[model samples]
Target: MSDGARVIVGVSGSLHSLTALHRAAEEARARQAVLVPVLAWTPVGGERNYRARPCPPLLRAWQELAEGRLEQALGQAFGGLPIGLPSQPMVLRGEAAAVLTGLADRPDDLLVVSSGEQGGLRTGLRRALRRSVARQCLKRARCGVLVVPPSTLHEDLRALHRGIDLRELAAA
Candidate 1:
Protein backbone atom coordinates (compact mmCIF):
# COMPACT_ATOMS: atom_id res chain seq x y z
CA MET A 1 0.00 0.00 0.00
CA SER A 2 1.28 3.36 -1.03
CA ASP A 3 -0.16 6.58 -2.41
CA GLY A 4 -1.63 4.79 -5.37
CA ALA A 5 -5.00 5.75 -6.76
CA ARG A 6 -5.91 2.39 -8.25
CA VAL A 7 -4.73 -1.20 -8.54
CA ILE A 8 -5.62 -3.41 -11.49
CA VAL A 9 -5.62 -7.15 -10.85
CA GLY A 10 -5.53 -9.52 -13.79
CA VAL A 11 -7.89 -12.32 -12.83
CA SER A 12 -7.83 -15.34 -15.07
CA GLY A 13 -10.06 -18.31 -14.19
CA SER A 14 -7.31 -20.05 -12.29
CA LEU A 15 -6.53 -20.63 -8.65
CA HIS A 16 -3.33 -18.60 -8.94
CA SER A 17 -5.15 -15.68 -10.46
CA LEU A 18 -7.69 -15.65 -7.63
CA THR A 19 -4.88 -15.64 -5.14
CA ALA A 20 -3.46 -12.65 -6.91
CA LEU A 21 -6.89 -10.96 -6.88
CA HIS A 22 -7.26 -11.37 -3.13
CA ARG A 23 -3.84 -9.89 -2.55
CA ALA A 24 -4.60 -7.00 -4.86
CA ALA A 25 -7.84 -6.34 -3.01
CA GLU A 26 -6.06 -6.14 0.29
CA GLU A 27 -3.43 -3.84 -1.21
CA ALA A 28 -6.14 -1.63 -2.66
CA ARG A 29 -7.91 -1.36 0.67
CA ALA A 30 -4.73 -0.52 2.46
CA ARG A 31 -3.71 2.05 -0.09
CA GLN A 32 -7.12 3.73 -0.25
CA ALA A 33 -7.39 2.83 -3.90
CA VAL A 34 -10.16 1.26 -5.92
CA LEU A 35 -9.70 -2.31 -7.13
CA VAL A 36 -10.37 -3.15 -10.74
CA PRO A 37 -10.25 -6.88 -11.38
CA VAL A 38 -9.91 -7.49 -15.08
CA LEU A 39 -10.87 -10.73 -16.79
CA ALA A 40 -9.58 -10.67 -20.32
CA TRP A 41 -11.40 -12.41 -23.17
CA THR A 42 -9.26 -13.13 -26.18
CA PRO A 43 -10.79 -15.14 -28.95
CA VAL A 44 -8.49 -17.92 -30.06
CA GLY A 45 -8.12 -18.60 -33.73
CA GLY A 46 -11.11 -19.98 -35.59
CA GLU A 47 -11.91 -20.58 -39.19
CA ARG A 48 -12.44 -17.26 -40.94
CA ASN A 49 -15.67 -16.87 -42.82
CA TYR A 50 -14.80 -15.59 -46.24
CA ARG A 51 -18.24 -14.24 -47.09
CA ALA A 52 -20.06 -13.76 -43.80
CA ARG A 53 -20.22 -11.49 -40.80
CA PRO A 54 -21.46 -12.45 -37.40
CA CYS A 55 -24.51 -10.69 -35.99
CA PRO A 56 -23.91 -7.79 -33.60
CA PRO A 57 -26.65 -9.01 -31.33
CA LEU A 58 -24.96 -12.34 -31.06
CA LEU A 59 -21.68 -10.75 -30.09
CA ARG A 60 -23.38 -8.58 -27.50
CA ALA A 61 -25.10 -11.60 -26.03
CA TRP A 62 -21.83 -13.42 -25.84
CA GLN A 63 -20.24 -10.52 -24.05
CA GLU A 64 -23.10 -10.51 -21.60
CA LEU A 65 -22.65 -14.20 -20.95
CA ALA A 66 -18.96 -13.75 -20.25
CA GLU A 67 -19.65 -10.88 -17.88
CA GLY A 68 -22.20 -12.94 -16.01
CA ARG A 69 -19.72 -15.75 -15.52
CA LEU A 70 -17.12 -13.30 -14.31
CA GLU A 71 -19.56 -11.97 -11.76
CA GLN A 72 -20.31 -15.45 -10.50
CA ALA A 73 -16.64 -16.21 -10.16
CA LEU A 74 -16.05 -13.03 -8.22
CA GLY A 75 -18.86 -13.84 -5.82
CA GLN A 76 -17.61 -17.34 -5.28
CA ALA A 77 -14.02 -16.27 -4.69
CA PHE A 78 -14.52 -13.13 -2.62
CA GLY A 79 -17.88 -13.53 -0.93
CA GLY A 80 -16.36 -14.36 2.44
CA LEU A 81 -12.97 -12.81 1.78
CA PRO A 82 -13.35 -10.27 4.62
CA ILE A 83 -11.91 -7.69 2.29
CA GLY A 84 -13.38 -4.26 2.96
CA LEU A 85 -12.52 -2.56 -0.26
CA PRO A 86 -14.27 -0.74 -3.08
CA SER A 87 -13.74 -3.19 -5.92
CA GLN A 88 -15.35 -4.41 -9.11
CA PRO A 89 -14.52 -6.88 -11.89
CA MET A 90 -14.41 -5.82 -15.52
CA VAL A 91 -14.59 -8.20 -18.45
CA LEU A 92 -12.78 -6.80 -21.45
CA ARG A 93 -12.25 -8.05 -24.98
CA GLY A 94 -8.54 -8.43 -25.75
CA GLU A 95 -5.43 -10.42 -25.03
CA ALA A 96 -4.69 -10.82 -21.33
CA ALA A 97 -1.13 -9.49 -20.93
CA ALA A 98 -1.55 -6.64 -23.37
CA VAL A 99 -4.76 -5.46 -21.78
CA LEU A 100 -3.10 -5.45 -18.42
CA THR A 101 -0.03 -3.63 -19.70
CA GLY A 102 -2.19 -1.01 -21.34
CA LEU A 103 -4.05 -0.34 -18.10
CA ALA A 104 -0.74 -0.03 -16.28
CA ASP A 105 0.05 3.00 -18.39
CA ARG A 106 -1.99 5.17 -16.05
CA PRO A 107 0.04 7.40 -13.76
CA ASP A 108 -1.37 6.35 -10.43
CA ASP A 109 -2.23 2.77 -11.27
CA LEU A 110 -0.49 -0.38 -10.11
CA LEU A 111 -0.49 -3.68 -11.96
CA VAL A 112 -0.96 -6.89 -9.99
CA VAL A 113 -0.90 -10.19 -11.86
CA SER A 114 -0.14 -13.81 -11.18
CA SER A 115 2.87 -15.37 -12.83
CA GLY A 116 4.55 -18.80 -13.11
CA GLU A 117 1.20 -20.62 -13.14
CA GLN A 118 0.75 -20.97 -16.87
CA GLY A 119 2.84 -24.11 -17.22
CA GLY A 120 0.32 -26.47 -18.80
CA LEU A 121 1.22 -26.26 -22.46
CA ARG A 122 2.53 -22.96 -23.72
CA THR A 123 2.63 -22.86 -27.45
CA GLY A 124 5.59 -21.07 -28.98
CA LEU A 125 3.55 -17.98 -29.76
CA ARG A 126 1.92 -17.90 -26.35
CA ARG A 127 5.24 -18.07 -24.58
CA ALA A 128 6.73 -15.35 -26.69
CA LEU A 129 3.72 -13.08 -26.29
CA ARG A 130 3.62 -13.46 -22.53
CA ARG A 131 7.29 -12.69 -22.09
CA SER A 132 7.07 -9.69 -24.36
CA VAL A 133 4.04 -8.27 -22.63
CA ALA A 134 5.46 -8.75 -19.15
CA ARG A 135 8.73 -7.07 -20.03
CA GLN A 136 6.93 -4.14 -21.58
CA CYS A 137 4.75 -3.64 -18.54
CA LEU A 138 7.73 -3.77 -16.21
CA LYS A 139 9.45 -1.12 -18.25
CA ARG A 140 6.47 1.15 -18.85
CA ALA A 141 4.19 1.07 -15.80
CA ARG A 142 4.15 4.42 -14.02
CA CYS A 143 3.51 2.88 -10.66
CA GLY A 144 4.95 -0.29 -9.18
CA VAL A 145 4.09 -3.70 -10.59
CA LEU A 146 3.39 -6.67 -8.32
CA VAL A 147 3.98 -10.00 -9.98
CA VAL A 148 2.54 -12.52 -7.57
CA PRO A 149 3.44 -16.14 -7.98
CA PRO A 150 1.16 -18.86 -6.63
CA SER A 151 3.63 -20.12 -4.07
CA THR A 152 4.82 -16.78 -2.74
CA LEU A 153 1.84 -14.43 -2.49
CA HIS A 154 0.27 -16.16 0.48
CA GLU A 155 2.93 -15.13 2.94
CA ASP A 156 3.51 -11.78 1.32
CA LEU A 157 -0.21 -11.11 1.61
CA ARG A 158 -0.21 -11.92 5.29
CA ALA A 159 2.22 -9.06 5.79
CA LEU A 160 0.10 -6.69 3.71
CA HIS A 161 -3.34 -7.80 4.93
CA ARG A 162 -4.06 -5.30 7.66
CA GLY A 163 -7.63 -4.23 7.06
CA ILE A 164 -7.10 -0.75 8.46
CA ASP A 165 -7.09 2.82 7.23
CA LEU A 166 -5.39 3.40 3.92
CA ARG A 167 -3.88 6.68 4.93
CA GLU A 168 -2.10 5.02 7.82
CA LEU A 169 -0.69 2.26 5.68
CA ALA A 170 0.51 4.67 3.07
CA ALA A 171 2.07 7.04 5.57
CA ALA A 172 3.98 4.24 7.20
Candidate 2:
Protein backbone atom coordinates (compact mmCIF):
# COMPACT_ATOMS: atom_id res chain seq x y z
CA MET A 1 0.00 0.00 0.00
CA SER A 2 1.10 3.55 -0.64
CA ASP A 3 1.76 5.77 2.31
CA GLY A 4 -0.68 8.55 1.60
CA ALA A 5 -3.40 7.90 -0.98
CA ARG A 6 -4.93 5.10 -3.03
CA VAL A 7 -7.10 5.01 -6.17
CA ILE A 8 -9.22 1.88 -6.35
CA VAL A 9 -10.77 0.93 -9.69
CA GLY A 10 -13.10 -1.94 -10.53
CA VAL A 11 -12.02 -3.77 -13.68
CA SER A 12 -14.05 -6.37 -15.55
CA GLY A 13 -12.30 -6.22 -18.96
CA SER A 14 -15.31 -4.67 -20.65
CA LEU A 15 -14.84 -1.56 -22.79
CA HIS A 16 -16.67 0.56 -20.24
CA SER A 17 -14.48 -0.86 -17.49
CA LEU A 18 -11.35 -0.18 -19.54
CA THR A 19 -12.45 3.41 -19.92
CA ALA A 20 -12.87 3.63 -16.16
CA LEU A 21 -9.47 1.98 -15.69
CA HIS A 22 -7.83 4.57 -17.91
CA ARG A 23 -9.54 7.36 -16.04
CA ALA A 24 -8.43 5.81 -12.75
CA ALA A 25 -4.85 5.64 -13.95
CA GLU A 26 -5.01 9.30 -14.80
CA GLU A 27 -6.39 10.04 -11.35
CA ALA A 28 -3.69 7.99 -9.68
CA ARG A 29 -0.97 9.68 -11.67
CA ALA A 30 -2.26 13.14 -10.86
CA ARG A 31 -2.72 12.41 -7.18
CA GLN A 32 0.51 10.41 -6.79
CA ALA A 33 -1.52 7.56 -5.38
CA VAL A 34 -1.17 3.82 -5.65
CA LEU A 35 -3.46 2.38 -8.30
CA VAL A 36 -5.37 -0.67 -7.20
CA PRO A 37 -7.17 -2.43 -10.04
CA VAL A 38 -9.51 -5.14 -8.84
CA LEU A 39 -11.29 -7.86 -10.77
CA ALA A 40 -13.99 -9.68 -8.85
CA TRP A 41 -15.44 -13.04 -9.77
CA THR A 42 -17.92 -15.59 -8.57
CA PRO A 43 -18.24 -19.31 -9.20
CA VAL A 44 -19.93 -20.61 -12.36
CA GLY A 45 -23.09 -20.99 -10.35
CA GLY A 46 -24.18 -18.86 -7.41
CA GLU A 47 -22.48 -19.26 -4.01
CA ARG A 48 -25.23 -21.55 -2.84
CA ASN A 49 -24.71 -23.86 -5.79
CA TYR A 50 -20.94 -23.81 -5.28
CA ARG A 51 -21.35 -24.63 -1.61
CA ALA A 52 -23.45 -27.62 -2.52
CA ARG A 53 -20.92 -28.93 -5.03
CA PRO A 54 -17.70 -27.75 -3.32
CA CYS A 55 -15.20 -28.60 -6.03
CA PRO A 56 -11.79 -27.29 -5.05
CA PRO A 57 -10.22 -27.88 -8.43
CA LEU A 58 -12.85 -25.90 -10.26
CA LEU A 59 -12.62 -23.10 -7.76
CA ARG A 60 -8.86 -22.89 -8.27
CA ALA A 61 -9.27 -22.84 -12.03
CA TRP A 62 -11.83 -20.06 -11.86
CA GLN A 63 -9.52 -18.00 -9.66
CA GLU A 64 -6.70 -18.50 -12.15
CA LEU A 65 -8.94 -17.37 -14.97
CA ALA A 66 -9.86 -14.22 -13.07
CA GLU A 67 -6.14 -13.51 -12.55
CA GLY A 68 -5.56 -13.84 -16.28
CA ARG A 69 -8.45 -11.48 -17.01
CA LEU A 70 -7.05 -8.83 -14.68
CA GLU A 71 -3.69 -9.04 -16.43
CA GLN A 72 -5.29 -8.93 -19.83
CA ALA A 73 -7.42 -5.92 -18.93
CA LEU A 74 -4.38 -4.04 -17.68
CA GLY A 75 -2.47 -4.93 -20.82
CA GLN A 76 -5.28 -3.86 -23.08
CA ALA A 77 -5.71 -0.57 -21.22
CA PHE A 78 -2.04 0.40 -21.04
CA GLY A 79 -0.21 -2.25 -23.10
CA GLY A 80 0.79 -3.32 -19.59
CA LEU A 81 0.61 -1.55 -16.25
CA PRO A 82 1.28 2.14 -16.83
CA ILE A 83 4.98 2.95 -16.68
CA GLY A 84 6.09 5.14 -13.79
CA LEU A 85 2.83 4.47 -11.97
CA PRO A 86 2.58 2.26 -8.87
CA SER A 87 -0.11 -0.40 -9.20
CA GLN A 88 -1.43 -3.36 -7.23
CA PRO A 89 -3.71 -5.67 -9.21
CA MET A 90 -6.04 -7.98 -7.35
CA VAL A 91 -8.30 -10.89 -8.31
CA LEU A 92 -10.86 -11.51 -5.60
CA ARG A 93 -13.77 -13.89 -5.36
CA GLY A 94 -17.02 -12.05 -4.68
CA GLU A 95 -19.66 -9.92 -6.32
CA ALA A 96 -18.06 -7.03 -8.21
CA ALA A 97 -19.72 -4.22 -6.27
CA ALA A 98 -19.14 -5.79 -2.87
CA VAL A 99 -15.48 -6.50 -3.45
CA LEU A 100 -14.77 -3.04 -4.81
CA THR A 101 -16.62 -1.23 -2.05
CA GLY A 102 -15.00 -3.43 0.57
CA LEU A 103 -11.50 -2.64 -0.68
CA ALA A 104 -12.22 1.07 -0.97
CA ASP A 105 -12.95 1.42 2.70
CA ARG A 106 -10.70 4.39 3.36
CA PRO A 107 -11.34 8.08 3.70
CA ASP A 108 -8.62 9.14 1.29
CA ASP A 109 -9.20 6.43 -1.28
CA LEU A 110 -11.03 7.10 -4.55
CA LEU A 111 -13.25 4.40 -6.02
CA VAL A 112 -13.62 4.46 -9.79
CA VAL A 113 -16.27 2.50 -11.66
CA SER A 114 -18.16 2.53 -14.94
CA SER A 115 -21.69 3.90 -15.21
CA GLY A 116 -22.61 0.71 -17.08
CA GLU A 117 -25.16 2.46 -19.26
CA GLN A 118 -23.91 2.04 -22.76
CA GLY A 119 -25.53 0.25 -25.73
CA GLY A 120 -29.20 -0.21 -26.58
CA LEU A 121 -32.40 -1.36 -24.92
CA ARG A 122 -31.04 -4.78 -24.04
CA THR A 123 -28.12 -3.29 -22.19
CA GLY A 124 -30.35 -0.91 -20.30
CA LEU A 125 -32.71 -3.71 -19.42
CA ARG A 126 -29.93 -5.96 -18.28
CA ARG A 127 -28.52 -3.31 -16.00
CA ALA A 128 -31.97 -2.45 -14.70
CA LEU A 129 -32.63 -6.09 -13.86
CA ARG A 130 -29.56 -6.20 -11.64
CA ARG A 131 -28.06 -3.91 -9.06
CA SER A 132 -25.50 -1.95 -11.05
CA VAL A 133 -21.97 -1.99 -9.65
CA ALA A 134 -21.53 1.74 -10.21
CA ARG A 135 -24.77 2.51 -8.43
CA GLN A 136 -23.82 0.24 -5.57
CA CYS A 137 -20.40 1.81 -5.22
CA LEU A 138 -21.90 5.27 -5.26
CA LYS A 139 -24.30 4.28 -2.52
CA ARG A 140 -21.97 2.28 -0.30
CA ALA A 141 -18.39 3.41 -0.82
CA ARG A 142 -16.70 4.98 2.16
CA CYS A 143 -14.38 6.93 -0.14
CA GLY A 144 -14.98 9.27 -3.02
CA VAL A 145 -16.64 7.49 -5.94
CA LEU A 146 -15.91 8.41 -9.54
CA VAL A 147 -18.41 7.02 -11.97
CA VAL A 148 -16.93 7.15 -15.46
CA PRO A 149 -19.41 7.26 -18.26
CA PRO A 150 -19.01 5.02 -21.30
CA SER A 151 -16.76 6.54 -23.95
CA THR A 152 -18.09 7.45 -27.37
CA LEU A 153 -16.03 4.62 -28.78
CA HIS A 154 -17.80 2.20 -26.51
CA GLU A 155 -21.19 3.47 -27.63
CA ASP A 156 -20.10 3.31 -31.25
CA LEU A 157 -18.88 -0.21 -30.84
CA ARG A 158 -22.15 -1.22 -29.30
CA ALA A 159 -24.06 0.40 -32.14
CA LEU A 160 -21.87 -1.39 -34.64
CA HIS A 161 -22.37 -4.69 -32.88
CA ARG A 162 -26.11 -4.14 -33.17
CA GLY A 163 -25.77 -3.40 -36.90
CA ILE A 164 -27.11 0.13 -36.49
CA ASP A 165 -26.01 2.61 -39.13
CA LEU A 166 -23.82 5.26 -37.61
CA ARG A 167 -24.91 7.93 -40.07
CA GLU A 168 -28.54 7.43 -39.13
CA LEU A 169 -27.68 7.88 -35.46
CA ALA A 170 -25.66 10.93 -36.33
CA ALA A 171 -28.51 12.44 -38.35
CA ALA A 172 -30.94 11.74 -35.53
Candidate 3:
Protein backbone atom coordinates (compact mmCIF):
# COMPACT_ATOMS: atom_id res chain seq x y z
CA MET A 1 0.00 0.00 0.00
CA SER A 2 1.09 3.61 -0.49
CA ASP A 3 2.61 5.44 2.48
CA GLY A 4 -0.02 8.13 2.65
CA ALA A 5 -3.08 5.98 1.90
CA ARG A 6 -3.27 4.29 5.27
CA VAL A 7 -5.48 4.28 8.35
CA ILE A 8 -3.29 3.80 11.40
CA VAL A 9 -4.78 2.61 14.68
CA GLY A 10 -2.91 2.48 17.96
CA VAL A 11 -3.45 -0.77 19.86
CA SER A 12 -2.48 -1.84 23.38
CA GLY A 13 -4.20 -5.21 23.74
CA SER A 14 -7.04 -3.54 25.61
CA LEU A 15 -10.71 -3.74 24.70
CA HIS A 16 -10.77 -0.01 23.96
CA SER A 17 -7.77 -0.23 21.64
CA LEU A 18 -9.25 -3.26 19.90
CA THR A 19 -12.46 -1.32 19.36
CA ALA A 20 -10.42 1.52 17.86
CA LEU A 21 -8.70 -0.97 15.56
CA HIS A 22 -12.06 -2.31 14.38
CA ARG A 23 -13.30 1.21 13.70
CA ALA A 24 -10.07 2.09 11.88
CA ALA A 25 -10.41 -0.99 9.70
CA GLU A 26 -13.92 0.03 8.69
CA GLU A 27 -12.69 3.53 7.94
CA ALA A 28 -9.86 2.14 5.83
CA ARG A 29 -12.29 -0.01 3.87
CA ALA A 30 -14.56 2.98 3.29
CA ARG A 31 -11.63 5.13 2.16
CA GLN A 32 -10.07 2.38 0.06
CA ALA A 33 -6.90 2.64 2.16
CA VAL A 34 -4.73 0.13 3.93
CA LEU A 35 -4.98 -0.51 7.68
CA VAL A 36 -1.88 -0.19 9.82
CA PRO A 37 -2.11 -1.25 13.46
CA VAL A 38 0.66 0.22 15.62
CA LEU A 39 1.62 -0.69 19.18
CA ALA A 40 4.19 1.43 21.01
CA TRP A 41 6.01 -0.05 23.98
CA THR A 42 8.89 0.82 26.30
CA PRO A 43 10.75 -1.10 28.97
CA VAL A 44 9.53 -0.40 32.50
CA GLY A 45 12.92 0.26 34.01
CA GLY A 46 14.33 2.41 31.27
CA GLU A 47 15.93 5.69 32.44
CA ARG A 48 15.67 4.75 36.07
CA ASN A 49 17.53 6.80 38.69
CA TYR A 50 19.76 3.89 39.51
CA ARG A 51 20.56 3.11 35.88
CA ALA A 52 20.90 5.41 32.87
CA ARG A 53 19.02 2.98 30.68
CA PRO A 54 17.72 -0.56 30.53
CA CYS A 55 19.95 -3.28 29.05
CA PRO A 56 19.58 -4.40 25.47
CA PRO A 57 18.29 -7.80 26.49
CA LEU A 58 15.46 -6.25 28.49
CA LEU A 59 14.55 -3.95 25.64
CA ARG A 60 14.49 -6.87 23.23
CA ALA A 61 12.23 -8.84 25.57
CA TRP A 62 9.80 -5.95 25.89
CA GLN A 63 9.74 -5.45 22.14
CA GLU A 64 8.98 -9.13 21.63
CA LEU A 65 6.15 -8.99 24.15
CA ALA A 66 4.73 -5.88 22.49
CA GLU A 67 4.84 -7.58 19.09
CA GLY A 68 3.02 -10.60 20.50
CA ARG A 69 0.37 -8.45 22.09
CA LEU A 70 -0.08 -6.52 18.84
CA GLU A 71 -0.58 -9.78 17.00
CA GLN A 72 -3.19 -10.89 19.51
CA ALA A 73 -4.99 -7.54 19.26
CA LEU A 74 -4.98 -7.83 15.46
CA GLY A 75 -6.48 -11.30 15.72
CA GLN A 76 -9.14 -10.07 18.12
CA ALA A 77 -10.00 -7.10 15.94
CA PHE A 78 -10.19 -8.91 12.56
CA GLY A 79 -10.60 -12.56 13.57
CA GLY A 80 -7.25 -13.43 11.91
CA LEU A 81 -6.32 -12.05 8.49
CA PRO A 82 -8.35 -9.00 7.57
CA ILE A 83 -10.36 -9.29 4.38
CA GLY A 84 -10.58 -6.64 1.59
CA LEU A 85 -8.17 -3.96 2.83
CA PRO A 86 -4.49 -4.68 3.34
CA SER A 87 -3.53 -4.81 7.03
CA GLN A 88 -0.09 -4.45 8.62
CA PRO A 89 1.04 -4.68 12.25
CA MET A 90 3.70 -2.26 13.50
CA VAL A 91 5.46 -2.51 16.86
CA LEU A 92 7.10 0.77 17.78
CA ARG A 93 9.53 1.30 20.66
CA GLY A 94 8.56 4.54 22.39
CA GLU A 95 5.77 6.22 24.29
CA ALA A 96 2.35 5.51 22.80
CA ALA A 97 1.21 9.10 22.39
CA ALA A 98 4.45 10.36 20.86
CA VAL A 99 4.70 7.44 18.47
CA LEU A 100 1.09 7.80 17.37
CA THR A 101 1.45 11.55 16.98
CA GLY A 102 4.53 11.11 14.83
CA LEU A 103 2.70 8.70 12.54
CA ALA A 104 -0.26 11.07 12.35
CA ASP A 105 2.01 13.68 10.79
CA ARG A 106 2.26 11.58 7.64
CA PRO A 107 0.34 13.19 4.79
CA ASP A 108 -3.09 11.75 3.95
CA ASP A 109 -2.85 9.20 6.77
CA LEU A 110 -5.68 8.90 9.27
CA LEU A 111 -4.71 8.14 12.86
CA VAL A 112 -7.18 6.41 15.17
CA VAL A 113 -6.87 5.72 18.90
CA SER A 114 -8.98 5.04 21.96
CA SER A 115 -10.12 8.25 23.66
CA GLY A 116 -9.44 7.22 27.22
CA GLU A 117 -9.40 4.35 29.63
CA GLN A 118 -12.73 2.90 30.78
CA GLY A 119 -13.93 4.22 34.16
CA GLY A 120 -11.46 3.54 36.96
CA LEU A 121 -9.61 5.48 39.66
CA ARG A 122 -6.29 5.23 37.83
CA THR A 123 -7.84 6.40 34.60
CA GLY A 124 -9.55 9.24 36.42
CA LEU A 125 -6.20 10.38 37.76
CA ARG A 126 -4.70 10.22 34.31
CA ARG A 127 -7.55 12.25 32.90
CA ALA A 128 -7.20 14.73 35.72
CA LEU A 129 -3.56 15.12 34.74
CA ARG A 130 -4.68 15.64 31.12
CA ARG A 131 -2.24 12.94 30.06
CA SER A 132 -4.46 10.92 27.78
CA VAL A 133 -2.88 9.68 24.56
CA ALA A 134 -5.88 10.67 22.46
CA ARG A 135 -5.81 14.19 23.85
CA GLN A 136 -2.18 14.52 22.82
CA CYS A 137 -2.92 13.26 19.34
CA LEU A 138 -5.82 15.66 19.01
CA LYS A 139 -3.54 18.51 19.96
CA ARG A 140 -0.57 17.62 17.77
CA ALA A 141 -1.79 15.57 14.83
CA ARG A 142 -1.31 17.10 11.38
CA CYS A 143 -3.41 14.41 9.69
CA GLY A 144 -6.95 13.34 10.45
CA VAL A 145 -7.39 12.09 13.99
CA LEU A 146 -10.19 9.87 15.28
CA VAL A 147 -10.51 9.36 18.99
CA VAL A 148 -12.86 6.41 19.50
CA PRO A 149 -14.44 6.58 22.94
CA PRO A 150 -15.68 3.58 24.84
CA SER A 151 -19.26 2.31 24.41
CA THR A 152 -22.03 4.55 25.69
CA LEU A 153 -23.45 1.77 27.90
CA HIS A 154 -20.64 2.45 30.38
CA GLU A 155 -21.53 6.13 30.49
CA ASP A 156 -25.22 5.28 30.84
CA LEU A 157 -24.46 3.06 33.84
CA ARG A 158 -22.44 5.81 35.49
CA ALA A 159 -25.20 8.33 34.95
CA LEU A 160 -27.77 5.91 36.35
CA HIS A 161 -25.79 5.45 39.57
CA ARG A 162 -25.12 9.16 39.87
CA GLY A 163 -28.82 9.96 39.46
CA ILE A 164 -29.78 7.52 42.22
CA ASP A 165 -27.21 9.04 44.57
CA LEU A 166 -28.27 12.57 43.71
CA ARG A 167 -31.89 11.73 44.49
CA GLU A 168 -30.90 10.25 47.86
CA LEU A 169 -28.84 13.35 48.68
CA ALA A 170 -31.74 15.62 47.74
CA ALA A 171 -34.06 13.66 50.07
CA ALA A 172 -31.59 14.19 52.91
> Quick one: best TM-score, which candidate?
2
Residue 66, model 2: lDDT of 95
Expressed as tens digits, the lDDT of each residue in 7-38 for candidate 1 is 89887656677777878887888778889888
Question: lDDT tens digits, residues 77-142, model 3?
Answer: 777758777977799977788898887677799999998567789789878966888888888888
Candidate 1 vs 3: which has more TM-score:
3
Steric clash pairs (candidate 2): none
* lDDT: the better of candidates 1 and 3: 3
Measured on C-alpha atoms, candidate 3 has an lDDT of: 0.81
What is the lDDT, from 0 to 100, of the residue 151 in candidate 3? 66
Candidate 1, which segments miss by more than 4 Å at Cα? 1-4, 44-52, 80-83, 118-136, 152-172
Which portions of model 2 miss their true places by more than 4 Å? 164-172
Top candidate by lDDT: 2
Ranking by TM-score: 2, 3, 1
Please, what's the RMSD in Å of model 2?
2.0
lDDT of 2 by residue, 67-158 (tens): 99999999999999889999999999999999999999989999999997665788878977887999888889999999999898877777
